[model samples]
Target: MSLLKEAFERFAPDYLERYGQSMLPSHRRCLTDISSCQTDALDGSLHVCQSCGHEHYTFHSCGNRSCIKCHHLRTDKWLDKQQDNILPTRHFHYIVTLPSELRPIMCSNQKKSYKILMTSAFDALQKLASDPKHLGGKIGAIAVLHTWSRAMIDHPHVHMMIPAGAYNKDDDTWIRGREKFLVPIDALKSIFRAIFMKRMRKALPKQIFPQAIWKKKWSIHINTFDSKVENLLNYLGRYVYRIAITENRVLAVSQTTVTINHNGEALHLRGEEFIRRYLQHVLPKGFHKVRYFGIMHSAHKQTRNRIKLLLMNEVIIPDRPVKKKSTRCLKCSSTLILSISVLAPRNFNCQASVHPP
Candidate 1:
C-alpha cells in the first residue's frame, strides 16, 4: 500500500474531528476521496487470468484529480494535448507572486483570488506586449497556479508560459520580441501590481488587515525559455497535476508523526499537522488551476487555426507515446477477463484473492 494512503487512513479522522467545522466542502471531499482511493470503499472489478485460471480483484480508483495515483495518466494526456497548441516560436517563462501579507486572504478566498491572479497576470502581459515599444501585437499566455512552497507553506504564485512574440492583426504577421527580452521587468511589475490589487481588493473582505501590502512591490520574474517544446512539456508535467505530497516524498508515517523530505531536508510533523498542511492546497471544486488567455484562449478557435496555418512549416511537435490499456495480467502474463462488476464491501482487503474453481 502507498504511504500517502496509509497516512490518510490513519490521521484523516483525527484531522477531520478537530478541523471539520472550518474545512471547506471541497477539502472534505478531497480528504475522503484520497482516503478511500483504490480502497474497498470505492468498488472492485473481479478479473480472471485466461491462461493461469487465476482470479483476483482490482479495486476502482477515486479518480480525484489531486490523487497522486490517478494523476499520472491525466498528466500524460494533458501534455500530449498541449503539443498541438504549442506555437512554433520562442516562449518566455514568467512568474507572478503575491505579496506575503495577502496569503491569508487568498487561502480563505481561493477561487476568487486565484482567478484574479491569473487574469491580472495575463492582462499585464498582454497589455505590455501590445505596446509598440515591446512587440506591438497580441500575445498568447498559458498560466498555471501553484499554492505551495517547497516547505508546504501557502505561497500563491502563477507560472506563465508566454510566446515571446505577438500576432499583428493589421500587418497580418508575427512580430517577435527581442531575442533575449520579452518586456521591461519594472513596467511589467507595476502593471501587474496595479491590476492585481484593484481586482483583489474588490474580492477581499471589508475588515481585513495589513493595508500596508498595497505599498509593497510585488515580484514579477521573467526568463526566456530557449529550449524546445519537448523540454518545456517535460518540465510542465511535473506540476500540471501534482498533489501537495506524493507517496514517494513521504518517508514514514507513524501513529502520531509523519516525516517528509522538504527540499532535501528532513522534517517531521505531527500527523494532524501534516494533513492540515496538505489539504490547504486542495483547490475549490470546479476551479481550474491552468488557464489560457489572449491568442491562446479556447474561445479563439479561428485565431488559433490561423496561427497554426501560419506556422505550419516550422518544426513539428513530436507525437506523444500512446498509453497502453490495462488489459493484461501482471502476475501470469495473460489476458485478463472481467468476470464480475459490483460495489465492493467497506472493509474488503485488496491483497486477498479468491481461488479459481
Candidate 2:
C-alpha cells in the first residue's frame, strides 16, 4: 500500500471529504474525467494472511492534477518530454526579473503583458547576439515565468535556457558565443530593461500606467549564466512543475495563518492578513505562467527545426532509458510491486487540455 492509502485509512471520513470529492468546477470536471478512466471494481474479495492475520482491501485515487497523491506520474512524464529537447553544449541558466514594485501591474495585466515581457526579453537577447561586435547570431532560449517566491509571495520572474551558439544571419555562420560569457551582462541588462519597460507601457492604458516605474531609472540585474549545458537542463527540468509551497516548507499552520520556513531556520513568523494575501496571489484560474520561446515557440516550429539541425553538428545525445526508482514500503521492511493503470483523462492542463500546463 502507498502512503496515501495509509492516510486515507487512518483519517477515513475527513480524508474522503477533503480529497476524495471535488470542490471547484474545474475540480469537478477533472474528477468526472478520472471517473470515466477508472475500471469497474470487477468483483474482488478482501484477503487476509494466514500466519500474520493481516487484512487489506483495494481503492483508487482520483488521479486529479491538483491531488498530491496523483500528478507524480504526470510530472515524471513531463520531465521525460523535456529531456529530449535539450541540446549538446555548455548551456547557461538565466533568471530575468522585474522589480517588486512592478508586481501589481503584472497581476492586473496577466496574459498580454506577460507575453510582451517574454517577447521583449527574447528580442533583446537576439539583437545583442546578432551584433557582430557581440556574438553575431540568433540565440536559442527557453523562457519560464515564475510568479511566486519560496514563501508564496508574488514575485514575477522568467527563467531562461540559452545554449552557447547562434545562427549568424549576417555571415551565415554558426557562431559559438564566448564560453565564459554568452552575452555581455551589462549590455543585456541595459537592453532588456528598456525593451521590457517599453513593451509594458504599451500593454497598459495610458491613464493607469505608473509614471515612477515608466520614468524612473532603476538597475535591473542580469546575473551570470552557467557554463555547463547538462547542469542547466537538469536544474530547469526539476523546477518546471514546482508547487507554490510543499509539505516540508510548511513549518506550521495555525487557525489564522500558514508559517513557512524558507531557509529552515524555524523562525516563527505571523500575520493572518499577510498569509491570506500571499495565498490569494497564488495564480487565478486558467493562468499559464510557464512558456517557451525561440525554436521551442509554438508558432515558430519551422525556425526551430532549422536551428535543431544546425545544432546537431553530427553529434547526437544518447537516449538513456529511464526506469522506475526503488520500490520500498516506507514504514515496514517490505518490497512493493507497482501496478500500471491507464487512468481516465484528467483535466490537468490549463484550459482543460490533454496534457499538464
Candidate 3:
C-alpha cells in the first residue's frame, strides 16, 4: 500500500462519519465516487493490478471539494482559467473582513446575507470610484468569498482582485493608478458599513440583527496594499483548495482534542464537541466559494475581451480534449468499449470485438 493510502484508510472513514453530514451536495457526490472506486478488502488487504500484476493495493480519494485530500486537477483547471484572465497591468488583492459580531446573521441567512455582502461591497467600490475626487472611473474588480479562518471559524469576507487602472468616463480613457492603489480607508469603511446597514434594514429578518451589533456597528478591515500581486495571487490559488484541516496539516486527532497545525505552529485544542461546527462552514452544494464580479461577470466578459485587446498582451489558452479513437484490445484487434474513465486515481477500461466484418 502507498503511504498516502494508509493514511487515507485510517482517517477517511472516521472523517466522513464524523463530518459528512455537513458536506455540500457536490462534495457528497464525490463521496459516492470514492466509495464506488473502493475495492473489496480481503483481510485488510486490497486487489492487485491485473495487467501488470502489481500491488498490495491502491486506495482512491474522495476528491470532495471540502475534503482537501486531492486537489491536483481541481487546482490545475482553476489555474488554467485564471492564467489568461490576468491583466498585464499591476493587480492588487484587497481583503475585506467583516466583523465576527455579524456571524449569526450571516451564517443563518447565508445565501441572502452573502448576496447582500456582495452588493454592499461592490456598491462601496463603485460609489467611491465614481467620485471625481477619487479615481473617477468605472473600476473593474473580481470579488471572491472566503467564509472560514484556519480552524473553521465562521468568518465571512471578500477578496477582491482589481486591475491597476479603471475607465475614466470623462476623458474616454483608462485612468491608470500607481502601484500603491489603495482606496481611502476611512471612506471605504464608512461606505461599506452604510451599504450593509441599508441592505439589512430593508431585507433581513428582525431577529438576524441583534440589538448589540445594530447599536455598536460591526468593524470592517481593509488590508494594506499587497506590494507584489504575485504573492497574493499565489496565496489565492492555495486558499481555493483549503479545507478546515487536512491530515497533512493535522498533528493528531484524539478523543477530546483536535490537534491542528496553523501559522507554522502545532497546537491541541478542543471544546466544540460536534463536528458540525467545522462542517457548517463547508460551502453549499455547487456553491462557488470563489467568485468574480465587475468586468469578470459573464455578461461583461466581452468587455474583458476588449480590455485584453487594448492591453495587446494576449495569451493563448490551453486546449481541451476532443472525442477520439480508442486503444485496441490486446488479445484481438477490435475497438474497445470505455466502461469507465475517471479523472483521478486513474481508472479506464476498454474492450474490443474478436473480429470486425
Note the Cα lDDT for every prediction shown: 0.79, 0.55, 0.59
Tens digits of per-residue lDDT, candidate 2, 227-285, equal: 34445555565555543444455565444444567776654444433333333344445
Using TM-score as the measure, the top candidate is 1
Choose 1 or 2, whichever is better by TM-score.
1
Candidates 2 and 3 compared: the better one by lDDT is: 3
Q: What's the lDDT for residue 226 in model 1?
A: 58
- Candidate 2 stretches with Cα past 4 Å from truth are 1-69, 169-172, 214-228, 253-257, 267-287, 298-321, 325-357
Query: Which candidate do you rate higher for TM-score, 2 or 3?
Result: 3
Q: Please provide, for model 1 over 66-109, each residue's C-alpha lDDT reduced to its tens digit, 9 standing for 90 to 100.
A: 76556676787788877777787677888899889989988888
Off by over 4 Å in 3: 1-63, 169-172, 211-228, 246-248, 254-256, 270-274, 309-357
Tens-digit per-residue lDDT, 11-102, candidate 3: 44665776578766644554444344333321122333344433333334445665544565566567656655755556666777776778
TM-score of 2: 0.66
* Distance from true location, Cα of 178 in model 1, Å: 2.2
Clashes of 3: 2
